[model samples]
Target: MEFSRRAFLAGTSALAAPLLLAKCGFVGGGGGSSSDDADTLTFTTWGTDAELAGFRAAIAAFGEANPGQTVELNAVPYEQMFTNIDAQLQAGNPPDLFRVPYYTFGAYAGQGQLLDLGPYLSADTQDRFTPAAWAAVQNEGSPFGLPHHTDTSAVLYNRDLLTSAGITTVPETAEEAWTWEELTGVAQQLRSALPADRYPFAYNWQGNGVTRWLSLLFQADGAFLDTDQRTPLIDSDAGRAAVEFSSSFFSNGFVPANNTTTSASYASEAWFGGTAAMVWSGAFQIPDAETTADFEWGATFAPRNVRGGSDFGGNALVATAQTAKPELAAAFLEFVTERDLMADFCRSASLLPTRADLQGDALTFDVRPELAPVFAGQAATVEPEDAAQVASPFMSGIIPVLQDQLDQAFLGSQDAAAAVTAMAAGIADATR
Candidate 1:
């Protein structure tokens, strides 16, 4: 997770252009003008060069296949994407189709800004997606988007480091996966065996870090929100244990003192620099790790407690409610998400496809041979039951409060039980 300078430049440029357009009162194609023309469709999304390239290839393929239809792609930087889309929708000029982060889909759909896609979905199309994939875009028994691609988190370890710590076997399957206590014991061993600067474990300790925490809560058989998704459940017994287990890593010095301030790049640096033995990260890191690391590394399921589950994070395609050409937008969405095109896109972009059938080795295993199965295995653990319980519109609003209280517990300002209780209280207030 090193952010390339090119990505930063592209993000800044994309960010500035939208603000300039808003300041000039130039509402581009508001009031559904762009979607009214059957020959053309506007699609908005954000990605890096590789992702944009994959998308462009798909768009070109769609144009060639449809013969008179033109698909225009508007790609922004990842950082400014959601804000820019919010602005465009507010100005009443959203693209015919746009990318939605699964977690935020509920917020926009709840506002009646996105088209309910249930009518457009057929049995055949629905069958193409995995249950977890389909569950990600639905709200209150209606579909708002179509699945694009997905990924789940896993623990990547430095094999050489582990072997040096007198560990011969690494957990390769869920049946053999380490428990939280077992993982902490191994981390302790590595802490003593490694150099003074090295820590035992690290993760992306920003917003994504909060996702990892949620996974831990699930592994402890806890829920963030109740079955209705409107009630806060962060004060449950499982929640307290999850928080205490996580806070101990920091309090016991298994994690660095400056972890809260550390960025993803710093964590990657520690892992790649051989100062850290393992990283709790998503499957997207496999390609980068294979390219840069000199030492041998492997990935496995995230340590399990009572049960195991991983966070399924990805983007999906949705049509705006203002789209005048609903059929055309739906066609384009189907075109890009078709089985062959999606498989190619996932292969080219090094992403995990949302299709259950595409989980074969022919796509990613050929590239990063060692780590692909671990990712695939982790993805298999992301069940529809977990999605129904964990994914919520309130999540976007409550994450900041949850993160703040967790940080306080980690830094010793509040005890774990108190922090968990406060987080639940804060979420209850927000939802009310």
Candidate 2:
């Protein structure tokens, strides 16, 4: 993969913004227990203000219930999670009960850094949450992590802008969302009516471009990568189609031409200021968008592919193998994941708590109901089960290669097929 000869003005904030990655782990221990069997614990997690607040609310009861135990929150920048985790592990000190992203689960579990909670989970416990929501930690044959929640995007649109462009109709179902051809027609229409300085749509991260670049990947269809993890699934025809579809915006002119330097703040500001009519981002961004938009705005499921798809990202709670307080940590985990507490947790964070009951009807026509389409699309779309696995900060460093090389396709330098070929080579190179 080749990078455009350029510099990005956006400050590198250690994106923990989310990317697929390898894995890393950490450990944490609280004060020793009065008894040998007692284990003290500490925890860590990542997210924006609303998410953190919601999590705090969920754990409040747990804290009160176990006043005698020590529970600490370790807030680390999402981007540096893996790096910080490694440094701590090397230093012989780490948080005892920390969160792990889906991507890192394999690495952490493979390294024995994260204590497997499989033996601890009973069939009754397993049935408490939706199987789909647990996509993060469910590997080949065993479950390595406990899913707490999930994240997916919706198209945040400017109602006024749509009306101005005479595109007043709103989609009520995924099928109603625009088709790629139809989307391009709108982009052309929007450009003709709007100022040249304005863009029709804006999105964060690089993969959305990839998603647009291709229609789908063969590996995803049936040959899903075997346990070996060295498969050429993404380079298939369907994969290339999906890759090109995502990149078409830059290649086709719906998105800004000079996109490498386009930062998250730029897109958010554009969406709010009306310079951009639509923004693609996870449901959690509602609070951010709400605080900034002037006119009416709302979310809808993203446009469909041959099949509808959306990226999934989320967190998992796990106890470390050497935790001095497993019982206390386990209690904390159980408390936060309880159905009663989970809704409050999801509401505060604007997260779709993984608990089966909390993931469904609990979100409609209430508590920022505009986000319902995002979750609905997630549950219905035929998406890769391992979405969170791609969000690990551990493999973040490698994504840039894939990002830059495919950026060419986005810029129309190469076709989607070539771009993905470059991506496969890049992933192999990075892993080696």
- Please report the candidate that would top TM-score against the real structure: 1
TM-score for candidate 1, please give it. 0.88
Give the per-residue lDDT of model 1 (tens digit) for 100-159.
777777777777888776565444666678887877776666667888998777888899
Query: What is the per-residue lDDT of model 2 for residues 123-145, given as tens digits with 9 covering 90 to 100?
Result: 45556666455544554334556
TM-score of 2: 0.80
Which residue pairs clash in candidate 1? none
Report, for every candidate in turn, its global Cα lDDT versus the true structure.
0.74, 0.58
Off by over 4 Å in 1: 1-36, 261-266, 360-366
Q: Number of the top candidate by lDDT?
A: 1
**What are the TM-scores, per candidate, against the unseen true structure?**
0.88, 0.80
